[model samples]
Target chain A: MPIRYPNGQPYSRSPKQGQAKKPLPADTYSGRGMTLEQDIDEANLYYLSQQRAVVHKKPTPVQIVKVDYPKRSAAVIREAYFKQASTTDYNGVYRGAYIDFEAKETKNKTSFPLKNIHPHQVDHMREVSKHGGICFVLIRFFQSAEVFLLDAKHLIDYYDNQDVRKSIKKTEIERLGHQVKTGLHPPIDYLRTLDAVYFNGDAKERT
Target chain B: MPIRYPNGQPYSRSPKQGQAKKPLPADTYSGRGMTLEQDIDEANLYYLSQQRAVVHKKPTPVQIVKVDYPKRSAAVIREAYFKQASTTDYNGVYRGAYIDFEAKETKNKTSFPLKNIHPHQVDHMREVSKHGGICFVLIRFFQSAEVFLLDAKHLIDYYDNQDVRKSIKKTEIERLGHQVKTGLHPPIDYLRTLDAVYFNGDAKERT
Candidate 1:
C-alpha cells in the first residue's frame, strides 16, 4: 500500500529514490528532516528560555468544518482546509522594538525568486514598516547553505520595480542582506545581526 | 443511534430535547450561536477592509504527531494535540503603535474572575506595555450586554495585589475601563475606544 498525495502521486520516504525526498544536506534545513521553520521555532524556544528576546511563529491556520466525537476521547477534526495567512509568519517585541518577518527558502543558486513569496506577505511587510515595526525576510539559499536577512523595505522596493526584474539578483542580495551567523543552541542567530541594524551601539546602553 | 460526548452524555440539537444545545440568549454568545471571538473576528475583518487598523488573531497551534494522506484529497491530521500559545490571542500594529491584548467573556455580573486569565498572558501584556506598546483586555459581560476595554496596567496592579482580593470589583472595572461603543460596520468598535485611551488628542495630529 502507498500513500497518495493530492496530485495523485505516491508520497515516499526513500532518501535515495525520490526527488521530493532527496537526501538531506548536512548543513541545510538541519539535515535531519527538520525544516527551516522548525529550526527558527527551536531558536525562538531558546530565545524564550534565555529571556534574550520574545518572538513566536504564527500557527498554520486551518478552517475546520466538521468535528467528530468519540465515546471517551477528545473531539477529532474530521474536515478542515488550510487557510492563507494574512500576516507575516513571525512577530513579537524584541528589546523595545517590534519585530515582524517572514522566512523562506530557495534552491535557486543565481537569485531568490519573488514568486516564493505571496503578494499578501509582501504587502504585510510593507505595512509593518510603515507603522514603525522592524520588518524583514529571512531567506535561505539551501543549495549553498547561506541565509540572509533582507530588510522588508528593500524587498518592497524590488517588488515595485518588477518592470525591471522579477527576482532579486544574488549580487544585490549579498550586498544588501545581512548574513545570519549559525549558532549551536539556537540554530540561526539573526537577532545578533538585527541589533546592529536597529539598535546600533545603543544595545549596550540598554539593560 | 446517539453520539456520545467524552463526558458520557449524548450530544443534542434541540433546545427542548438536549442539555448541550439549549438556544443561547441574544446578548449571550449571540444565542444565534455566534461566539464573542467570532464577533471580534468580523470586526477585525472590517478593520482590515477599511484600512483603519491591522490586527489579527493568532491561529490555534496544534502539535501534529501524525498525518494521513488519503487517496482523493488533502492530507488529514490523523493524530495531533493542541499546543498552548506563548503569546496573547491578538496583537498587531495600529496607527504606528503596536497593540497587544486578549479577549475573554464571563457570565458573572458583579466581577470578572481573574481565574479566566492566565499568568503568562498578564506577563506578556506587561512586557508589551513596558516596551511602549498599547496593551489591554476586552471583557464582555454576556449577561449585562456590556463590553469594556480595561488597560493592562490596571489589571496588572490588581493581579499583583492578589493577596488582598482575587477579583477586581465591578465598580473598579467600570471606573477604570473604557466603555466600547458598538458600531454598525465593525460590530465592536474597540479601536474607537482605544483612540481615546492611547491616542487621545494626538490622534487628530497623525495623518
Candidate 2:
C-alpha cells in the first residue's frame, strides 16, 4: 500500500499519481483557468510568512509614456508598455545563499521548447551563475502536473546547443533535473531540492 | 596635500571628505533639484552595466485597478494605486551575499527622524538580519552632504527603543555608522563601506 497524505490520496510517486494530487481545476498548473506562476507565487508567500526565505517575483517594470492627473482623483497612467526584466522573475536570500530563478509552464507532453525562454534570460541566468548565485528554472509540465527544478548550467548547455536541437526532450530533463515534490501547504517545495543540488555540489554534477 | 584622483583635487582622506566629494547640485543628497535615492539608482545601473552586482530597486508595486486597450496604441492603466512594499526598496546579490537596504534622505541637520522609516520596514529588516542577509539603511545628511551605511542592528535598536528616544542624531550616526565615500563614477560607492560593516566586522563596528 502506498503512503497516503492527510487528504487521503496516495503519495504521487510518479506522473500517473499526479492527477490524484490535483483534483480541483485551480490545482492544475495549466488548467486554462489557472497558472503555474500563481502556484509559485502562493508558495513564495507561505515561505515569506514562515521567514524561511525572502523570495519575491519582481514587479513587471512598466514604461509610462503618458499620465493624466484628474481633478480630485488619483493619477492615471494613460499609456504604458512592459519593460523587459534585467534578472530572473524571483530572487532572494535563502539561508545565506542567494536564490534566483524563472518559472514557466508548458502544456506539451513530450518536450520543453527553448523558445519559451528568451535568449536574454538565458544570458542573464548564465551571468548570475558566474556570480555564485543559485540559479535554476521551475519548469512545470502541464500534461502531467509534474514540476522539475533544473539548474541553469543544464539550461545553458542546451541553450547554447540550440543550433543542434530546438527543444529539450523530456528524457533529458528527467535525467538532469530534480523533481520538486508538491504539497498542499506550499504547492512547490523547491528549496529542499536546492540543498541537494547546491551543497552536495560535485557529487550531483556527475549525473 | 589632499589626495585626489588622477583628474584633480586629491581624494580628501578624512571621513569628512564625504562632503567635499559631493559638489554638484545633483551630487547633494538633499539638493532641492536632486536626491540620494537617485544616486543609489544610478549607482545600481552602473553596477548592473559592469556586472559588479545584481542589485535592483524593486519597482514600486502598483495595484492596477483599470486599464484600457486602445485599438492601435499601447495599453493605458486608467486607475492604479501604489502598493505598500512588504520588504525594502532595494535587494539583490552582491558578491554571493544577499544585500538589502532602504535609502532615505533628511533635510534636518541635527537629527534623522525615525518617522522617515516605517515600522513594517523595521520588522522586515529585522527578519532579514535574522536570516544572515546583510541589511542596512543608507542615510544621507543633506546639510553635511555626508552618507552613511549603518547596519540594520543599529537602526533596529533605535526603532525598538523609540519609546525612550524619538530619533537618531547626526552625531550618533557619525559615531556608529560607516561613512560611505562618494565618488565621481559611482557617486555613492557604498559597497566600500559595506565591506567594512559586513565583512571586516571589527573595522566599522567600533565607529
Q: Which pairs of residues clash in candidate 2, taking residues 3 or more apart in a chain or in different chains?
A: B3-B10, B3-B11, B4-B10, B4-B11, B175-B207
lDDT of 1 at A28: 31
Q: Local distance difference test, per candidate? A: 0.74, 0.75
Cα deviation of A94, candidate 1, in Å: 2.1
lDDT tens digits, residues B97-199, model 1? 6788898777778888787777888888766776666788998887776889998888989888889898887788899898888666787899898888778
Q: Residue A107 in candidate 1 has what lDDT?
A: 74
Q: What is candidate 1's CA lDDT for residue A173?
A: 90
Model 1, position A62, has a per-residue lDDT of 58
lDDT (10s digit) by residue, model 2, range A130-204: 777788998899878889999999999999998999888988999999899887769889877887777675736
Best by lDDT: 2
| Regions of model 2 farther than 4 Å from truth | A1-33, A66-76, A201-207, B1-34, B201-207
CAPRI band of model 1?
incorrect
Using TM-score as the measure, the top candidate is 2
The per-residue C-alpha lDDT of model 2 at residue B56 equals 79
